[model samples]
Target: MIRPGLTFKLSILLACIGVLASGATGYYTYRANRTMLVNEAGQSLLTSTELLGQRFSAAIDDVGADALVLASLPSTANVVQTDNGLGANAPREQLAQVYASFMVHHPEDLQIRLITRKHYGLELIRFDRDADGLMRVEGNSLQEKGQFAYVFDTLAFSPGRIYTSPITVNHEYGTHAAEGKPTLRLGTPIADASGTVVGVVIIDIDLAGLLNRLQSDLPSDYRFYLANEWGDFLVHPDASKTFGFDKGRRVLMQDSFSATKPLFDQATSEVLLNGLVQPGQAAGQVLAFVRRPFGSSEGSRFIVLGLARPLQDVLSGATQLGNRIIRMVLIFSVLALFLAILFARALTKPLHILAYAATHLFAEHAMETLPLKRTDEIGILARCFDRLRREIKSQMDVLHNKQRELVHLATHDGLTGLPNRMLFMQKIEAAIAEATRREEGLAVLFVDLDRFKQINDQFGHSIGDKVLAAVAHRLTQVLCSADVAARLGGDEFIVLIEGPRSAEAAPGIASRIIGALNEELLIDGHSMTVGASIGISQFPDDGATAEELLLNADAAMYAAKSDGRCAYLRYRDVIEARKLKREQASEGATEGREAEPTA
Candidate 1:
């Protein structure tokens, strides 16, 4: 083969370099843009999911409030006590109209009724929305609901407590629009004047309609998802997948999206899924799921709410940028190929400089090494590299700062900037360990604000929050440098005092805290006075572990409250009182046995 000339070789080599550089740059830029877009979309979806969860909770609360309103009505009680609407036609008719009006305004309310316990939970007056409109059900249309859990369970609860039934399809006959539809029933007991549960005011909520209303304001493209605490899909994009249990099958969120397993396990409160990192059906979507507490039950009842958007929609801008990058790469490669034949010798020096700058891109004063001032193609490339480096470094710095902020937020209370229960437990455990090793004693002071609920009800949570923050501030001020104070959530705080004199110093610190809190506080043009009941538990004497110490301290705090507010009680005193009461009970039992006759 004939040997190639120097110009030809240089041109070919430059052409290869240009093509490789352009391809690599274009690929990396596309990748970076896609990643950025995915991150932003994930955050946006997560926010939407959280907002949806909140809206769902608020909607449930509103429904419960409505049930309360109907339950509290004098006419509702009067009609329920009248027994099958005899001699109570006027009140029953008026209540039916009220129910009809509510159904008219709230399209999600499928049926409203007043059912009494006397007639085996017979529906006295019922209004149901049908194809015609809201209408009253009379005569044979009335059904006995005492056998149903919604009626019996509701009657079990005292008045004013709303009982939420498990969401299920309403198979009850003669339900009109609610028949065979997904339904949630909220029932509250209606008590007579003597405080007896006479009947229940029941409202049947159309689950699908309520969800539609909740998501009405969201984007049309965003698909909504909902699952019960068991991870069974209550709502899904595919209609067949929802309520799979009703069809003698099972469809679970965790099975569909493995990333959501943690949500069902209760390991995490939220989950974010990226399609790029996922497979199968999830491969082209970004999804977020948030766990929301459901109903007013004290149990661990919750629902998982999710929102999903197509990945293609989120990367539309990146797609456009990729197209532009492709065009740019082709143009630059062609230009480099033509110019290489003329400037083959001249380009060597700048190429070395660029390579060195690339290696030291993040090094201090590295920009000085780049030939940015030159009015040449190499200079333009160098300037672009510099810009990229700056942007990358800025992004990294911001990421680090955000990571630190997140760590702080996870451990501290946002409202008061104090260590929260989780962080406090960790610190207390470590302190306890150290104290046990050194044969030293420490004190845990449990502080609870008295009448805080009243303050919240009287002035609202805004003023109450300010008062809590003020209390937290005073707690910090009253404690010594060796001591730590933490908020244990909602008008309660805990303190740990280390050092040899911890047990002796705890009483004084608690007294000071009580004094500090008792001082009048002026907030939002209102003067407010709040008092705290404090309890002290000594290390080794009260408990051997962090949990024990906290429990004992909490018990002592309640004892203080029982004695009177604005006072301090010690765990030792609580234990002694319990022991004395036990002894007294034993003595009474002995006396009763001794007094028993021949048997």
Candidate 2:
């Protein structure tokens, strides 16, 4: 309220008028500067996150390349073949020294193991750093590790590709980490000449060392964190939060930085959260995260790498500028604030829009083009956000496509492009349900090449693979559209003939498959003639379920091989009669084989 003094009211009016203009100008400038500074801070955070990911990616890639080369050595393959040979001692020693040399050269590596699958996975050669940091090769100390997911899981993948393990406390006794040093493993499969998985080469990485490398050469203020796919912190500034599972309690990154919880839910590979991150964290923690996906056909999903720092450090300069602007504004008359608050809303409008858009982008995985018309720094920030949204979407699409491909590759056979046993079993189970519901007859045909081993011996497995592919194509052509054909591995194949055909027609279908394979195949300029012996088993007649049907069909197929080289056999209820017939047929087959000349 103005004083009754006419001159005082007039003077206050003049002051208000002048301050309103100045306040409006100062407020706009303050907001524009603040937004720009925050934008720059965000950009710096993103850059640091990206640099961390790239550096770590490059380092792991180099390690993986080295692992591949080491796994490819001839002695590595021989180790699997000569596991039981008396002469293996020398070769094993050489491998141990070779791995020891690797650990010596790379002290950050906790252990290097060339392990083969034998009962529980067998360690053919293992070299690990002791608690004293000395690289030691254990020869007679080979232990069974088949139970570890790292050992068996890596065996499922093809050679040359690297598989990474989740970071955890090292549990194996008598090594560098026996005291529970944090560990991670990089594993690559060892393949024989025919591309068969013979063993796996695993390099144990020191997680503490990895964190040091990730933080190397960076500013003293910079901090790095690592987490597994589930967002459980694996590496943290406070070591106690890391691998909390080992302590029987789970402490998650999402729990600390609740803002990033949506990232994992959205399956995004990268994200950045600004503001207070966790309880007890500095009031202005800015955390940026990037996911490092690693696994075989199965997913342990990703290892999240993050770089975090105090936002106060980044905004210190901006804060100083803001204080100067505040001091300038305080010189204004009190009435000016009434108008400034009303006008400040319009200036901060863009900030709210940008914040809303960023939140929506991650939470909903949907986007609307931001208001990009302004020629100010806010507009530039909006443009960057919009671009990031587009890029994240593009990356997610690619990630989804790759995930689908991995799923397909996991279930399908690599050589013949047919469904492998895993997929085949699923289809058979489904087909059995359908048959049971409709009371329709179903057939399971087990087809085995009569002399596939002979073919492999005569003309390397390369030709054998080609022959198998050709046979797969022929089987697809002979079977009905409703039928499912799968390679049960090696030279054996199984087909689930669903509806569109009766059990009586199974023998005919099997015969047709046999006839199709009987034709000469020109594989790699070698005219090859191979015969198939297929056995037919009907659902509810020979067996009730998928496993039972497949088992019966397999037994019947051997009977077909015994009856004649190229023929089909049907499962019957009388096991003894079928056994007698197979025995007599085997005798005849022996006599026939005796008549052939070896040359």
Candidate lDDT (C-alpha), each:
0.87, 0.78
The local lDDT score (0 to 100) that residue 515 gets in candidate 1 is 94
What's the TM-score of every candidate structure? 0.50, 0.49
Candidate 1 local lDDT, 256-313, one digit each (tens): 9878888888899998888876756478998989998877643346899999999989
390: Cα error in model 1, Å = 64
Winning candidate number (lDDT)? 1
* Residue runs of model 1 more than 4 Å from their true location after superposition: 1-26, 86-88, 296-300, 324-599
Error at 474, model 2, angstroms: 99
In candidate 2 the C-alpha lDDT for residue 583 amounts to 100
The local lDDT score (0 to 100) that residue 468 gets in candidate 1 is 88
lDDT tens digits, residue span 66-121, model 2: 78888899998888766842234888777777777787887678888888866467
Error of 2 at 425 (Å): 71
Off by over 4 Å in 2: 1-21, 84-88, 135-140, 276-282, 294-301, 330-599
Single out the weakest 10-residue window by summed lDDT for candidate 1: 1-10
How many steric overlaps are in each model, in order?
Answer: 0, 1
